[model samples]
Target: MKRPDCPSSSHLSSTTPNAGRTWEEIVADKQRTDAAKIPPEWVLPPAVVAGAEARRSLVGAFIEGLLDAETCRITDMDVPDLVGLMESGAFTAVQVTTAFCRRAAVVHQLTRNMLEIGFNNALKRAAELDDYFRAHNKLIGPLHGIPFTLKDQFHIKGLETCMAFVGWIGTFEGNKGTGKEREFESEIIKEFHRLGAIPIGKASCSPETSNNILGYLWSPHNQQLSSGGSSGGEAVMQALKGSAFGVGTDIGGSVSMPASFNGVFSLKPSSGRISMKDVANTGPGQQIMPTVAGIMGRSVTTLRLVLKSLLSTEPWLQDPYVVPLPWRELEDCCPGKGLAKSKPTFGFMENDGIVIPHPPVQRALGLVKRALQEAGYETIDWGPPSNLESLQIHGHIARGDGCPDVWRALQLSGEPEVPQISGLFEPDGPRDPMSLPEYQDVVVHMRDYRNRYQEYWMSTAGLTKTGRPVDVFISPVTATAGLLPEKFFHAEYTNSTNVLDFPTVVIPVTFVDKDIDVGDPNFKPITETDAINMAAYDASAYHGAPAAVQVVGRRLSEEKVLAMAELVVEALSLCKAKGHGPSSVG
Candidate 1:
């Protein structure tokens, strides 16, 4: 079975009339149609586009400078705050939607992040929301009037689901006569509609966030670095405040890694905690390691709210794959929950003993550790089941079928495999799939690995001063702060959590400081991959990139994980107040 996303095609290059045109024609039509959606006034001038191209950073002042003061102020506010303003009638849904749509337009032009533009439709829906609010004299729901974007993998009623494949451009997941085009809506979209959130656009989705479609998406924080990917475009959008929040699919750190790289907050929950129903996915019958939809936003608060809102819809009732777990406020886990009890203990894993993160990431972990300690929380060095164990289980269980579907999807339009995923295919086609017995063996290994990991987590209670297992463990989101294109060399930090099926949240800690984040000169390599990862690190090249950490919790622990993330954010803010915070460094 192919991935749920259905691989993309190049072009039919129709040999007969009415067959199809060239890949170039498809790409041009796609771009032209998407561009037509943006209001004329939102179109960017050539000079400004040139200026954006010349800069290393397009975030903060750079991107905002292009927008009007109101749009900047509106877009800068996080989701919860924006919804609050709407509830108070200080801002209408149209106002919020228009602000984000305009800013998203500017961002798409500058970064090529948007794969499907829906500004006109978004504004129309926003008006309906405003009318409902006016008639009801009350807010519609928790997420009322918020604007959001999603990876192009989700089928929205008024937009295309390109998934960044040129051949898949005008069709519904590469099927020409499916009749579902623009008619079928993903389950999540239904939930979002009920909550009153308007989707402004769908973003680019590629193996490394690139394809023949919208081009490569660069990190808004540091133009020289990768936006992290398959969800890279969504991460870049959130980093640039293109939307109030974003939804991305993650099979193996797809959402978390990009969020970390783009300097945005993200939540990659245990598979069933969030609905994957109706979302275009990566693999089929691949439940041993299923792809999950994750939320990315400017802050943990935004991530928390979005997840909670989705849960409030009780998506499980409609999507069979969703775990029937309602949003657990887990009030007892929130700050000030001590009430004479011990504060939450935390686990810190600076390295997996396989690959050492670069200096920027090391500093980020150090900052988190110190902040947690200073805030009166107990911290312990964490050593769980070796990530190498997970490294073994992930790929086989994920693509044991050899991803023949991906090849066929690309072949539909005669599109060749992309460089990032080129190695995934053979010279002629996808590699032969592992036999069922072999695949089953890998599944058994994954089961045992997960069991061992859980046991190890529980055993940590014996090591913590609090006499309780650590509430969450902090680890690097990736070994690199910002990727220098293909120089990225490790995914153990993020992928291990996926294999374990644990819920994880990523928080941006600080900017990569070429000076302050100087790495150890006498470091010894633990393994060949480690050596290559370290050797790939160039402090100057990674500078200006965001350094981040992931807070990981046990399976189905999304609420607790989110609460812990807030704690980290608070602790870091406290550290900054003392003038020695990671934020103070760069």
Candidate 2:
């Protein structure tokens, strides 16, 4: 079991040799000379392959010949097809689960996306489902035997929820003697378990999915680019089909931004739709704008399936914070109903008009507008109030408590904060907690902003051909497709939705293209921040990054948001076929 390249205990007699080597020296030596020290099953090739070795470590060799022909064939199958196979006995749960696990193993070796490996546990559960079906002649549930991964933040029964903090490696949230370490489960975990979805493992995450545990999470679509953080790991996993679906948490744009950045779909509901109970948080005390669990997946239908099944468990009964309302089947919101009966009006806001979207993002928006118009959907220019209001409101409420809770958690181990979260604190400690009056003032401002936004939304009724309020307003998810480190300037696209408490569905509409996405010649700066954000735009660096739009709905109206998202997708498809301007996923 001794690796050739790695030093064995037998070789380190008395540990008197090379003990003074620096950490960087040790790591560099391992990377360059200790090839055998690398785990064979985890090395991923840079390219996609129709077949590859299931048990090899060489990235290129593995992907070039990674799986049994049958497994490789089934691995590329989508969710609905996989479900059909399960229902018809075309494949057993073991077969499907094994294929995905192997594929996931490869993905991890290549991307280092997973934090834990629960393939054995997942296969065991899959076998149990097979037994249940044999005994009762029924599917376990809608997501029967489906393999999925979660953001490391979710605690599973037998796995650790490290959330990428090294301090939390052995103890429960960095504490020992806690009985709940592996015994406890997140609310979402419970629901997924009941739905017969097995967790193959947990994915890596940075503050933007750029944490220390797994290093940088790169987009499978383009390894040279970032996967998008917070949920970057989950997004990459889904992009590579390492899981049937994946879960992530979004406070600002954690979930949506990654999904957009990695060319996947995600739903970031308003606070109460999904449960966050029993989940670890950095600053749990700041409950004003709480982080909610969101789903990321290959398709919108899969995301819907996960959400609908979670709702079936009636999570509200167990978690008091969960909304009591069940998932209302909105036949009224269906395209054939509200959307088809009228040329639904869409309020189009290209940019917040604060920080302008980069060329690729702008091109993506233009595509969406033309698609909607071609599909007989009315498009109106959306000129809303200053996004600067939410910019002010976000930081105050999101981190105003001085992040004492976050500080305490970090102190669990004497670990340095990751590069991504370094800006959250000063050299001394977390910033001072805002006073109660100032905090209350921010909250008041948030409330006023919401009412004014709603008023503006309603005012669109006068301008629309349908003479009704805009069905859904479309806007960029972020000012750019993928962010380069701390280049982000405007969070208004996402923060404004949070301030308004509106349901927002992020739809990946395009990729950053170096050739087509050029700088705007007539672009004018709206403010200092706007200028800085624009200046950070690099067409080449951003190439292949996914750009997406958010479909904003009224508070807690998830059904409507999803429905409109589908319609938008359909319209975009048609427009693309007809050779119109940029269509969805440009």
Candidate 3:
């Protein structure tokens, strides 16, 4: 009955020399190693580090104040601007790489977000890129010399991918004597390398965005709030402008939630758009709803550039799981599109009816709706299939196997499970896995749910004045602007997209304001989960945290989704210019 990937019961009793060490010691040693990777010149002073620790926010002027003029100039540019600057000979690859590495070093020291640091090697590679540019008198690719980071699940040459598991630290995903340690690379890394994007480091991931390796990652906008995970660290890095762009993996709301909480943009494409080959994951056998890679960046354009660049590599040639679709150039879904003379219609879902969003999130949705209407786009109220279906199917499909591999990985070093995931296993061991028949039934249920949802979407054509389906839908990224540890209730907003295999883009709108965003005095709960979720919302605690909305398109419509997201951004910008946007606090 033992699964091939799960560790045997005998292996649980067999402990390595490190088994005697406390988990705290293992984590501390790893932290020290990451800190030492930063060069002496890039290290922050004791006073500056102390100040940052004492501050509530490190984003905007705070983090930028620590950098020199050149570093500030280089780090502030988006991916396209960075590449254009390098190609124009106005800035060399080394300059851009060093600026981001230095800023990332500062971010790691303050937030403990980085799991592995590869700055020295990154600079060396930047030098080689500069040499190539000098010799050829042209750039290498669309992403030439743009520095970036990844979630720790990715394998990069010379870097270890522990994925926040203490037991997996020194070894390759918990196995020793594997020549592949620091020698092998993930398929996406190869694609990024070919595109000339530099990998500066790897970040931490866990539920609630905390792990033993890097501790908890907090929002740069409001340090009191959690950076939502399991892609929290990547979001924190993007918020601080540590890199031009970063990559993270998302199954549920991992990428979208963090990006929302951190005031950044992210694209969580449907499965198969991006490759997951050779990547380490806890639920490796969950193929029905596989985890897809997502891109986090400072702007919609940056996200578009990263995805388009990756598709240019034809990843399907190397990773069989990847779709063979190339980047399709689509006209903006604006007024000029050839589909119809009328402007695009938007399907707006303010809440799922089960769990209502917090006031800040509601305000964000209102702002987006008004902005779109003011910009000549029609908005329709959207009511898709209930997310209760996704809620049931997500658990069975994502962790139906009882997560024996996760328990086995923790057993490697005898490290205690972080509190966030401790409930996954019984005191003795992992819970019993579901039977094959039951699991298949849930899969069938999931397929039926997706079909019904699509049918509902198709039915919208009858509701819209344009006589066509809405271009894309808008909704809250999460129930709250920022997460308070252990306060998360429902994830259906983002989880439904995963279940339906829909492409989504997160667009930051405004920040939480305790002065204005308060609970409605006459509000009544629709369900038990809604009451619990609303009771957890503390406007005072969530103040200054970013609130965002997501633009969701049908499956395999990343290009159209990004374009529509840009439209959302444009609408919001115009709204803010006219002083009609939601009030934001620093």
Candidate 4:
């Protein structure tokens, strides 16, 4: 009081504006200046840091002791097993849903993987299924109370699809005046609801699962590495068994890369296979290489169930963009049946001959090759049109128009551009838009690339043991086991599929082992990027990263992709039996 009686020079000095700041403004300025500093790459996002603080506030002291054997057991069941339990009346939907919800809550506390929690609604829906089962004495559908999560881009009724945009927090697509706030629903989400699937929550997502709101999504298997982006949150959820299955979208390798990095199975079907209506998109105007919905889970069976169930709903009717094609119970294309032989020939591309796969991936390719050889399948070395061609077409059509839409969406919330997307812009703002003429050239290139790719694929007939075109081709999903943040140098593996509009199934075949997966120094690099990529390899750093291969089939040939993926999985299982290397658990 005595100091204040002198009109406190300290308070006066604080009030004295440097330019125009008031006393409170000066305090806020300092706080914001401190807050604006970016975190180290290795550190989790501030939001994740805050989640840990929140959990501590709520749980007090017992959170550490709570992770015991029984808790883990309940969390390990896959979608099919959970559905089997519910169908047999061994467990009601309510019981299964409650277990997963509790486990998911714990996972979110540890990993900050969830962006929205629909626990109350999910439990209520589960109870309804239990009652329906009691009355009908039959399961509702194949999924029947299966718990799952989706990337925040999917619109779920009663939940806001903020999709990590601060501007999208309070409204539909960041528009406050739009009356459709929580009322809109995505077409694929509608299919899930109709299939008796329960939505546990929404997952965090970003360029690589890093954003201002949700921060970084860490791989639950190994926290030191990234979860893989755009779909990283979905992959992490599946890795931790936070959900029985998860859904994410891919334009480039978003789904496959994340699924591979997290040691899970995923299917990135061609566009129109799964409807994307009402889903939030990055570049809505650019439809050349449109993003497609994909499924990630612990097993191929889970993926099959989701795909079959959705197709049964006739998604094409509600979504005009969806193809009217129904899921075909593919006639056995096995050699003795559809073909003249018992085993079909397959084209194999160990690497694109551009970027060489790392040691773990090379080992995985060898395992698959040996397995197929032992099983009596013809494996022809696949040499096709350069994927470098797809690289050029992918950038122009995918990121052309300077990504003005992505920039505008980011601006709505005043959220800073994530470091992953920082390069998309100039120091000032997004780079100049691609001119109309230039953009057209890219489209033409993409079309030509597809034509040449198909021609090359058909050319496999001459190389096959059976005079038929190779059933499917196998290749690495990425050159590296898991990417170091921003270290991804090649997309030829995945982008080639997009360019060809081919269907692909990603099967995790092995994991990185520092002991056996050391790169050979004598190995010659095919191109400069290949040499640079090899130089970036460190055995210890990549240890435990999942190694996967892509089973690629012709456009609309999902059946063949799934079947061939099953064959690859079986072949690898046989190889593991011979005591050759690491095994694929999924």
Candidate 5:
């Protein structure tokens, strides 16, 4: 599977060479080649791009105005409807591919969110899918002609994965002369190909790189705010409908936070639920708390379909680290799945006990709670092991090595550490790695916390009418309505999920309404962090940003979590009908 026409390095021209070039020269050349990939006709005028930058939001009318009617209609569709139309010949594969690529070109041009662009290769593959369907009178697979984006860490064929490190610009993960460069692909890429999903491009990865390649990627929903954690680029792409869905990696809130911030649905499955094989990573040796691939899309159904489609390929056979579990029909508690009569009772989180969520996040959590109660489902307060315990264990397990490898990657090209991640290292170099005994102590603490949490979860069976544990618990995805630079507060809820290895789904509930969601006059701080966090909440600063909640199921319970997420969505819809749910706009 050699990636033809995929240059290992972006050539300056027929006359120029890369030898002895400065890192600046290499970076400039890559950006030039990437922008050149978009068709000239699709490029927006400078004035339009400038106007978009000046605006507070890039979605809705501003972006839709740039696309033609047909492009708008095509790109607006979710994954399932796109596949159905492609299967029925109502739209050719090339049509859908071109629509998304056109919109993606606009997205990258406006936000600088693309690390690599592969529009030509994607169009060629879309034509091939159309050929297969014409010859066989059926879709090539369930995801036929669907376009998707990934965080730049994935090794997509026909795309160079620099992962935003300048030292990695012209090599296979910082090594030169490797024939596998740009030719190698991840396990999930192979599964996607088999299902006929096309890769349009790679999105920005990390470090809020306004100074680097994908310049200043921020929230598409509200440009005033930070997009989110590391998965911000992919989340913005989904928010703007650049593709049908997207894939990202999350160790803590990397995926969930951005999805929540941008107002989209995301599933961060427990490690081993999805394939992570051959993906580039910063801490490759950190397996005690393994990283997981997360899916972000327009709806819970799309997330479920994407995961189930991957599982159908039996990914466990290739990636042994992936669990051997297939999609469990019995576990899906969707309507008509025979569990309707026994609707799942939900656990509700008023607060995580360390830091309180912002007014908007608090409202989102309460809305979900009331929605469920109004829809005939039982809701109970959820209290488990303290998030502070998970916080300590997560730091050691995730970066106990002091992130020497991350520091080395930056030093490879002398790229200064961005302010976002500068805290991970000392002024001069990485911190000392934890000793074996100390690291083991953290692992032991993690196990104990997990055991206690599980005991508390199981004990809920005693409090329910059905005498069963609450199916899944819902809580704030983050403490803020949207992430703003230097305005950090709480991550206990998200960090604890990784520490406990639970499958969690982020459901976008509402947006920050400065008019309605004002700070509580009697709000009492529970900790120093809480006091500082609440003090920073200015209503005008956070207006119109998305607020969301996350649903957590027990470990490896993705099926149940997703189904329960669908139920939450349905319950919200029920409340909306009753005029007691989310507002139409912030």
Candidate 6:
């Protein structure tokens, strides 16, 4: 299969002339048009918007306070429930789609996370699905009539995918006559449409989740903290219940970090599990550590539903990059079927021996450990190969080209680099690209690192009483519960998974409690990065932010990873019931 081009949107306007407009004007016009796309009935009053801005958190009660009971009831339902309701004729596709579109519109107005709005188009598609259901008297597919949003990297027939770049707003990836603007769609988009899912909008993403188009996306759980970047907009949408689920891309912790910070569930499958053909990306030349698409939802079941449905379409037939493996129900079973009759053992890594997680994160890990122990699972201390190696390999491979393409994209629209990514380039232009030999040397190092890591994992069989390696391992999703502007220090927890191509899941555990998650005043630093990361932790500032942990499995083991994540969720629930879990607050 031929890989399609993943270009950005053109900077054109229907209301204003495309030419003779400043970059600022173009950006402003797009924002205005996007806001205008929301239905008048769905628009929030200025007072409501002001009120939401003033609040510290907009999740749960705060967001529900702004919606009618019907809207709340409809939007709160997960994908399975929504599908069941539609299939039983309890709700029409238009009704479900409209409720989410209205809520998404409100979410955008308050949070400014939306880059392209397709409310009208989404409703039209919903109506078409309803008509098809009426004519055939059967559902379209597993995801029929379910509404979703994605990071702006994806292309939808009527949606603009600029990925937050101002120069590519109206044209096809900054070109004037490409003729693919709003006409071409990504492979995943096509698959979702066939599965009966509707695309409602696209989200803004940047290095730290803030962007030129939508400003900084704050976590709805705590407005003071960041939602997380590159996929933060989608995370915010999911946290706000703006859509049933969402899609985001991750190269290094982009999807997992935001999902962690925003307090939602996410599955970052290994590369090739999902199709990324024709998706807009920055490091297209760096195929060695290619970006992979990830799914974010309120529940693991929703994530499973999406991945399973996509595989049913045989995505590899259209995108050679997608693995031919279909969803394996047998692989999802735990401690069952043709294997060990004994209880499963888990590998636990409290810290990377470099940077320790913040207090809330530490508490969250403790909760998981205690819960699993109470549930009769053996937990082992996990000491993998140094993340320092993954860090070196990741930095070299991810930016070996010096990001000239990113620099060129910004130049096309004259938009100043967002503060989050300004350090990537020099004063005037990109730095020198690495030589071929140097790049190859790093690649060899990466291979050797993967080998050593796998060997270390397999060697655990000698330590376990069952004579089997750990079923899965658990660790912090990041060094902090929620990001505080530019205070991010470590990515190895997530970056290692990317280097090894391991499938991972992010499960929200508890909220950050300032009184309990206080910093250790007498702590000693293990490394320079460790000291810098720990010093940036502010319990009072991160109060009420969500804290989460990551569960990792070997490469292409999405089913097992997701199943283990569900196990973690169940264990946490059991702990909470017994008052041993982390505190819960709205």
> TM-scores across all candidates?
0.95, 0.88, 0.95, 0.87, 0.95, 0.95
Candidate numbers sorted by lDDT from highest down: 3, 6, 5, 1, 4, 2
Least lDDT summed over 10 consecutive residues: which range in candidate 3? Answer: 1-10
Q: Give all candidates' CA lDDT scores.
A: 0.84, 0.75, 0.87, 0.77, 0.86, 0.87
Residue 204's lDDT within candidate 1 is 89
Query: For candidate 6, lDDT tens digit of each residue in 15-122?
Result: 223367766788888978887788788888999887777788888887887789999999999999999999999999999999999899889988889998888999
Give the per-residue lDDT digits (tens) of candidate 2, residues 349-378: 897867888888888888888888888888
Worst 10 residues of 1 by lDDT: 1-10
Error of 1 at 116 (Å): 0.3
Q: Indicate the TM-score of model 3.
A: 0.95
Model 3 steric clash pairs = none
How do the residues 281-372 of candidate 5 rate in per-residue lDDT, one tens digit apiece?
A: 98999998988999999999899999999999999999999989999974336753333456678998878888998999999988888888
lDDT of 2: 0.75
lDDT of 3 by residue, 250-362 (tens): 99999999999999999999999999999999889899999999999988889999999999999999999999999997654632233224478899999998899999999
lDDT of 4 by residue, 1-586 (tens): 0000101112211123323434345334433432332123223446654545433122212333444555456557787787888888988888777777776766676666677777778999999999999999989888899889999899988777877765566678867778889788898888888889999788888777876565666555445457788899999888777788999988888898899888889999998899999899888877778899999998776787789889999999999988898888655642223332357677889888799999999988888888888777889999989988988888877888787766766666345566777778876667898889988888888888788878987888888878888888999998988876667788779988887878888888887888889989798999999998999888887777788888889998886687777777776676678887456645
Where is the poorest 10-residue window by lDDT in model 5?
A: 1-10
Per-residue accuracy of model 1 over 1-586 as CA lDDT, tens digit each = 1101223433312322124676666777777887888888999999988778778888788788889999999999988889889988899999999999999999999888888888888999989989999899888889998999999999999787867766566688878989998988999999999999998889988777868776666787777778889899999999888899999999889999999888888999998988888877657678878899999988887888889889999998999889888887776667544321348888999899999999989989999899888888888899998989888888787778888878767776665565677777777778999998998899899899989988999999899887888889999998889877667678888889889899999999998888888878899999999999999888887788999999999999999999989888888888889988876322
The alpha-carbon deviation from the true structure for residue 326 of candidate 1, after best TM-score superposition, in angstroms, is 1.0
